[model samples]
Target: MSSAHITFDTTGDKIARRVRKMRSSAVRDLFAAATRDDVISLSGGMPAVSLLPVEDVRAATLAAVESPEARAVSLQYGPTNGAPGLRAVLADMMRDLGIRVKPDQILVTTGAQEALSLIAEAFIDPGDIIITEGPTYLGALQAFSAFEPDVRAIPFDDEGMRMDLLEEELKRIGKGNPRLKYCYVIPNFQNPGGVTMVAERRRRLLELAREYDFMVVEDDPYGRLRYDGGHQVPLKAMDENVIYLGTISKMLGPGLRTGWIAAPESVLARINLVKQGADLCGSSFDQIIVEHYFKDIPWQKTLQKFVAVYKERRDTMLAALEEFFPPEATWTHPEGGMFLWITLPDYMDTDSMLAEALEAGVTYVPGNSFFPDGKTGRNSMRVNFSFETPESITEAIRRLAKVIEDRLELYRVFIEAGALPGYDRKEAAMTDEKTPTPWEEVVADSEQNEEAVMQAREGNAEQIDIAEEAVRDAQQAAAPAEEAAE
Candidate 1:
């Protein structure tokens, strides 16, 4: 069916090197597998549409269509900077996150995806250096990769990206590549990882950005979806040099395709110019619809419902992982959001596991695709728990664990039979004769984490001081209660 030698000439505007350099995202292909009846996908980072405040959106839509002013807004082309009322609403929302921005600073886009794409078009030059979390959002990677930027990933822990490693990366940027542009971060309930950068790190990161003089793109589509509790300050809140990208997709409806970016005037202007070519402006109809939706909809009530549903799902997934997953397979316990990251033993390849997982009627996004550098997260995978039911979560994890068990067993058998290299193929194999039992390895990891926690407690004298101060304040307020108890 294939010819060995074929000469074909293609002439009309050949693919540019920058476009050619970019690769199709591995995660994008996941949707096809996800749609199958056999597969219970933990792969897609999609919010459940059934959970959205559809009635509220419908009410707003009817009101918008009926009103003369709103009808005009829907019919006519709007400004590139977005509708004025929506911009004001967005500014108010930003104030809650401690980001003070005016209407002029906000440029609305089709979605957060477009905001990132336009930013990449505006700012990233070929061979420019950009930084992101080691296991970052795949959408961002796809957006920025098209610009042919030399992307580097900073290491991340449960607390978020390692600031120490980020500092070192910043130091290398100008020396290694003079056109070094900016860093992108998802500070709260980060995609794939589900780790929130603590408040202290947010301040410290701003300090580092100021010191380095490189921009920080704070991409926060899911910050508002924090199911556990209180708000974390956006990185842009502390730094004027940062660009804040936000979306209503998670909370409202992705069908609206509404997202916005808050940045300094200069950057906003440049992004607008880039926006001129890409759809000219985000749909005027959608913008007006959203503005009306925000006005008519009681978002607080919708938010409460979302919190309750997602929290239940989160609890269900965590319980399932505990019950079914092997002790060696480590997973993050996210307080909020759709995803949790899992790390298998160093010998496991998530990409290879994905094929087996699909065959077993379960699916997950391979973690390596999240990393700016492709090979770093070979042992990890991202799981989405928010979209599935409790029973589905239980069944999916059971299947996944069976797949992993079978793979490990097969690996052992291959080595024993001499079908695989005899304990020395370090390049292609992660497992060898020395691999420990799953239970023992996971137990050891747990102990190590406990020890680390104890060590941190011992070292952190300031934490104790703060706790003591809080106790003193509480005692003073509750003196009458103390006396009654005595």
Candidate 2:
């Protein structure tokens, strides 16, 4: 009866082969729960949109349709590259990060998300080798998965992606490999990880990219959100050839849906061709709103307010985690960002633990979702501080810690029952340092909690049950007597 019916009748799968292989980030289900008033969700990397001044945004939106001349441009289709004024504003914004770029070199898209997919479409071929941090942005993994690239992820530490390890892999891949397309990085307050790439590491990455003859794609969503750190020069600042992605989603609001790619003119030329097919051009109305927001508004003061609030939230979450989480767990100490990474005992699986967390009135993005493979980092989960109140963050951590403790109890049972075939108690300790085992501490604490709850409730349990039965009997007797009389 329709085109959809005809497609289903003709096509066996109704999906492209490449697209069929792609998988969701396993967050949509959790997001549904996150919206519930009873749940404290640490899953989404949403900014505190309530912190942005409403009057300021209202003024920006009003400016878009203020006059006939404004409506002529804002409401009409424009260049695929971007609005000229917005591009200039973006270039000026880049100047603050020491990235000098011409307006002509920028390509505006729906969001930085669209930029990622376009980059994958422009460069990636089937089975092409691409490099990213081991636990990278989940959205990037989702974007690139459509192309079926053989993703090779390198490990990272506090300083950021280990350049020494990257160099080792670069040598393994050898020089000038055509299949090695690009080295994509989120150098500043990386998603999920919350670790910044130090200046020396940034330089080393650029050097390796040069030697390997591969493009360096920098996805800097949180660069301007710094709270207490010295500046780390952007990769684009060091080398103009680096493809830098910038977004107003963090500073302004994601609802505007504006982001731009500052790349070489040659790169823009290719991507612009692809962009024409992917939406003809971005929403002109949205671009106009953004241009005025940056140009007409004193966005700096608002940005400062965001930093202060975020810093307090981040610290609150950190302090709560310190006080609540088991000693077996570890998490990154981010100077500034919306999210932080928390890893639990290796024997634990966060993906599996999520159900209990939801039941406990909290939710988090399981760490494995960030990996290119769907099944790694099973012991870790990413928590957000930006969306929740300080009190909520603290309570969420406390609930999550209980979930972890429950898992620890199960593991202890397995160990005591000798269900683990080859586990060595000493070698399997959560930490190498000498301390009380998490199993022992968790069991002891659980016992104390159980005792307290039982003492409070069990004392009156028999009497309450007897009284409830007697009331039920009385109701049953009265019902029969009243029915007989009737």
Candidate 3:
């Protein structure tokens, strides 16, 4: 068959400019790669659906779908304000968080993703300033980018975003930009970096927002998934002015696509306008399912199941990190949530390392995609511990550590020759002083180059060898008999 020549319009300046300027999000593309079965993905902030209360949800949904009343809500159109029963339950849940919001203040959206987009559509004008953490939620960044907001990023430390830096940025913006709409934060159990903001910092942040006369958009989907200890109150609990975002995607399941935003009545009104224009309203069927799921089913039991399962996964990831990462790497210890942040030496780039790690048979989200300003965090990566089995976490972390060690060694050579200035020198310095190894550093580098590491087995590498032996045994058992025999 002769090929048909296709003609395309390439002359329209506006369309060409728009097409050239707009690009698909890096995170979205990364998610596509994460779906590969061969890829041990520590990327994408995905909850382990294997642990979801699926059976209960399914049963609740079946009951709801079977009921004549449920059939009407499920089959017919739903209110833009969401199902009244669901709204009432959500309002009560909000009250538990110390927000005395009524059901009228709630807007149910498809997901927190839709909630963010609606909020941006309602509040963010072109050229308006919206501050975010240095490494914030990629989904939020993508959602706000559509509105052409001038996004500003403030650096964050372990305690969360430095209030001093935020205050300084606020003052600087005040000098020129008074059209600051809001500051977005994931104060409890943040995505990509599982650091929780201290309660005092939450208070200080609200104080800053009040002083600056700006809104605080608190996106909290992971707070309810805490594994290790006493629960921390959400930042929204501390401020009546805060716009609170909550999702069942993590707790129940993402397939439900159910999430709600608790905001001031004025903001809720605006959000409703934007939301109505978007999807009309979230799934009426899903809203009814959620309500019945909460009412008829024992939600407390389901939540407990999630807590117990995810806590095990979290511990597994921590143990794997201790067994595989290089000595020069450091990672966050999350109290709750699916992600943990890893910071490599300055000379390492996580984007480059991602290619190498994937080639070596693992995957992680590069840190650059999370930055609103796209300025720093290149030498970092975000790993999700909630999706894969403990075995997968171990293998992924091990491969990643090898990649990091090789990169660091290459950088060390350049540094020794004075070609790289910012490379870490403390590794050599500590040896010169014969200082005791930091337990933290040891935990970071458990997956150094196996050959070189074997030689240094006298220096804590022995423990790694023992773990490797166990992995070998496990792999051997799973291998085909013919291959195993060979």
What are the per-model numbers of colliding residue pairs?
1, 0, 5
Query: Which model is ahead, 1 or 2, in terms of TM-score?
Result: 2
Using lDDT as the measure, the top candidate is 2
In candidate 2, the residue pairs with backbone N, CA or C atoms under 3 Å apart (3 or more residues apart, or in different chains) clash, namely: none
- 6-80, model 2: which lDDT tens digit per residue? 333567477799977888766666788988999999998889999989999999999999999999999999999
- lDDT values, one for every candidate: 0.78, 0.85, 0.77
True-structure lDDT of candidate 3: 0.77
Number of colliding residue pairs in model 3: 5
- RMSD, every candidate, angstroms: 15.3, 12.5, 10.9
Q: Per-residue lDDT for 1-486 in model 1, tens only?
A: 777887776853687777766767776788888899989988877777787666787887786678797788887888888988888888887887788999889999999999999999998888888888888998899999998888888877888989998888777664444587888998888888999898888888888766767788998887767777678877787777689999988778788889999999999999999898888877888888788777657786787787788889889888988887775578887768789999876556778668779999999988888877777777789999878888898899999999887655533433333223223323224654334334222222333433332333356555444445654665586698879899
TM-score of each: 0.82, 0.86, 0.84
**Model 2 / residue 429 / CA error / Å:** 7.5
- Looking at candidate 3, the ten consecutive residues that score lowest on lDDT are 442-451
What count of clashes does model 1 give?
Answer: 1
Predicted structure 1, TM vs. truth: 0.82
- Name the better of 1 and 2 by lDDT: 2
